[model samples]
Target: MGNALRFLYGQCCSEPPTTTTTYGGAGDQQLGHHGVSSTSVGVSALAQHLYHFEITSQVPEGLSKHVSSSKKAQSNWYKKLSKAWRESKPPPKTPEEASRLVIRTLQRHQRPDIEVDARAVADGDTVTVYVSTSDAPESSRVPQEVHMAAVERNEARAHKNYTKADALQKQIKDAGYGVLHINNEEILARKYRIRLRGIDAPESAMPYGKEAKDELVKIIDGKCLKILIFDEDQYGRFVGDIYCNGIFVQELMLKKGLAWHYTAYDKRPELEKWEKSARAKRIGLWASSNPEMPWEWRKNRREHR
Candidate 1:
């Protein structure tokens, strides 16, 4: 029976080893069993066939169903994730809009407000800006009217009406503003509280420094000075060359020797040449045998102090 069972099991498992068994009694009589036995030993074969049939019939359908469901679930999950990502992202802002937002934020933080208003003057070479506090009264804002006045003055200057032009220039200067004549045709003027450029003068002294200031004043104080703005100093003041009546103030001062060439900041290539010429001619401060450069004087004074 065991051998027959083994044979049946082998056949059920697709081809197995053949088995043969011999039973011997005490009297030396032998009983040999061969071929398949007519016993219930083939149960394992039936069970194995049933198991294989069940798996073959149901496994494909189960796999197909599972794959379809998993595909649908992944599609839905990806759709939801993409939708959420779009909702969470913010739109990009334009440059102008972003600048406005920044300004508003700064204002909210109690920062000082700066406003620029540009107006075209008649001559086409100038623009004017009137600056005033945000809380200033409407009547106190002078930028618009000043720009128009500057345009009128530029027209007058162009026509050689020096008297009228001078009067307007004085009015503008008295109002604490500077007028820029652009290409002798247009005007860009602004009302700004700024110190005079280059030379530092005392309130009262030998009037030498004041004389330098006055010379600058006579040339550029009331007339339309062409401003060549280069850069701003650490103090936020505009470091520029002032051209008065077509004269370079830096060169003028250097020629007269009234002012030493400010080599540290004034980087005009022609400065050294001008200084040499002035020294050879023995002009202004260079008239002295040992006239000290202003920078060296300032340094020495500071060190002594």
Candidate 2:
């Protein structure tokens, strides 16, 4: 069951992901070739079979026929398909619904689809979840197994159970998300997707990347950040402008030379000035005699692979 869930949540994404998004601004800057496509995995057929999605939509009768497989036609078809999917059904609105959608991602060519019965139990290293093609009436409540875990965590806190709280926190993190403590008042857990805006941090495997991430962690590891979401990216991450204790996150990263100014998407002159100062001062990655940009690195990596 654990393996099943893992596959559903992760394994089906085998394709080289790409997303071409043009940033609309004064110059109509094309995005850096670094964007990722949607995170939802699996083929359209498999996904539809598992999620009850339909591919056919009223894309004008002869709209596709006249195009003859041209690039422009492909783009139009993609937009039409995306629009159809959006208009067909609303996105998952609750945690349980979202989880169900994720679990259905497990259906692929190599694996059989499982039924969702809203029953899952976890004992030691063993986890058992009932699967059926026919879903039971959608339950507003979290699955019993997950709910029990949440209850245990709450009970631990009530008794000042540091050991239990710490353990449960690890468990939650292992399951793909983190726990948030609210003003020392309540335990909060929810799915979230926040991408720091106006700058791109180096991947952890790159030079000074760990330092950049570590600095971010230092700034807000145990605190809530003020986030203003501007939009959602194709990958479903929130394109958010974040602040730490009133300090703009992008500005600070620029000052430290920990991130790129993300000129492809943002064109603020102040940000460019900060990047210039960091470069002149030879701080962080700028200290390197020659540092490779993350976008270029990713591009090269993909090409070589």
Candidate 3:
């Protein structure tokens, strides 16, 4: 099953879009490249076999006709399909119903996007998440065997069966999954460190730094975040925008004056607007006549050291 999903994901990536998106902002912005095309991944036979409908570019009727052959289009389709699949309670009763659902979902998202789950916050602008094998839209469901293995490993450790536990751990790692513990609950997940895009907050020792961290924790703690990854930084942290319950996390921080818009790396007009609003109101760090930038603080600390 793992191999099959990998093969299908490769099929999604094998073809590039006819056109690439250009970012006029600062630094290099890496948008959604990790995407899957539902139309090409064995969807035709499923539609035909189950719905008695032939989905092809030649025939071009129903869902097939509307979907673009481009990779970007397919990626967007998959993101919508993923959201729909999660929201669908009774699931689709028939192939026609499923096809209709796909059509509806495809209409909403026109841009490329990537997604991940947040597990912990390092500060106001950095977080840790787990990206397991199931993060892919093609394989939204985690393999049952992996879950069982995790449970078994825990039992083995409890029983002092170190050898057995080690073997099971190896199996889990080989399958691209890791064992995680959150509030004493054992979880199977992968670790991903992410840096919030377009904003830089104060360091821990800086003014309002603790407040900034606390506010971030308050907003995201125990809540699943929808992260749109843009790029990866030198420290191996993914840089992205975080959305919690449809609220833009970065916007809140900037508007509250907890963070500064890192204009050198990001040129989002909204980020600049939010920061300006906070500054005008003298909120958070903006209350200081001359707040030291986190970058500058880090530089001074380095020089002193």
Candidate 4:
């Protein structure tokens, strides 16, 4: 009886035996025996937990979809920023300049369909433009006094002192520089005198001169312009093509008979065509049988002077 009791005690303390079993296919999972034993159940659960961990390890469980989206957005922004940096002439000089450039580029990207603005119209064939400080070339040199005035004006404005800011701004403007508020941002700009290319208008005292100037003003006043600079004239004016609201300025002047094609300087056939059209229609200066050429009038005036 004592020997039988010892054998029963040994059986109760011993672990249950496990049997290996092959699944349907050779590549399929091989598991332990499907017996009603604690060891087999624990072995199956462990395999399941490990399989789940392998899948989840590739991408952690706690991360959200927002993180992936943010990374994609950052990559897109980096691509655009790189392109803008390459195209930027005289690249950024400081952290502030870089920030401003990024902001301006993004704004332009957002409103690519809109037109840009010009400063003012000087005459029938001349325009005044303001180049923003951010767009200024590296070699551009601003007068020390003008730069100082600009700095002080910015500070004054920041402190809510409009009177002082206005005075400082006036001084800056007197020095041939100006601060323009574009898109609700303050931009310091340099002045440029631009002469319209491919056409010549009458002098202020000549026939239809006032009419030509008035017509140009009527078409471009308070409107933005796109200028393509060619060369600088002897009068320190930039000779360039001017487009206002998508209309070629020289073409308008020629079509209206307010200007001569100035074939000696510009040989574009389009200018000649427009002038001939206006002449045939007897528009503006064309109403006179023989209007004096502006160059001849200027030469005579110079000789008299």
Estimate TM-scores for all models.
0.35, 0.43, 0.54, 0.57
Q: Best-fitting candidate, measured by TM-score?
A: 4
Model 1 misplacement above 4 A? 1-207
What C-alpha lDDT values do all the predictions have? 0.41, 0.49, 0.62, 0.61
Q: List clash counts for every candidate, in order.
A: 4, 3, 1, 0
lDDT of 1 by residue, 221-254 (tens): 3344555566666755555565656787667766
Clashing pairs in 1: 125-186, 126-187, 126-188, 127-188
What TM-score should be assigned to candidate 4? Answer: 0.57
Q: Per-residue lDDT tens digits of candidate 3, residues 1-305?
A: 22222322333224333333334465654222112123332332332222211122222123222221222223434445555744666544344545555656654532222223333667778887665332245235556667667657866876899999999999887876676543333445655688999999998788888899888988877665788989999998989998878999999999999999999999989999999999999999999999999999999999994
Model 4 regions more than 4 Å off: 1-119, 136-148, 157-167, 181-185
Q: Give the worst 10-residue stretch by lDDT in candidate 1.
A: 118-127
Model 2 per-residue lDDT tens digits across residues 99-199: 45545432221111121111211111111222221122211223444434544665576589989978876775565433333223222233445677678
Residue 101 Cα positional deviation in candidate 4, in Å, after optimal superposition:
13
State which candidate, 2 or 4, has the greater lDDT.
4
Q: What's the best-to-worst order under lDDT?
A: 3, 4, 2, 1
Q: Against the true structure, candidate 4 has what lDDT?
A: 0.61
For candidate 4, the C-alpha RMSD (Å) to the true structure equals 23.5
lDDT of 4 at 42: 35
Candidate 2 Cα lDDT to native: 0.49
Give the Cα error of residue 262 in candidate 3, in Å. Answer: 0.2
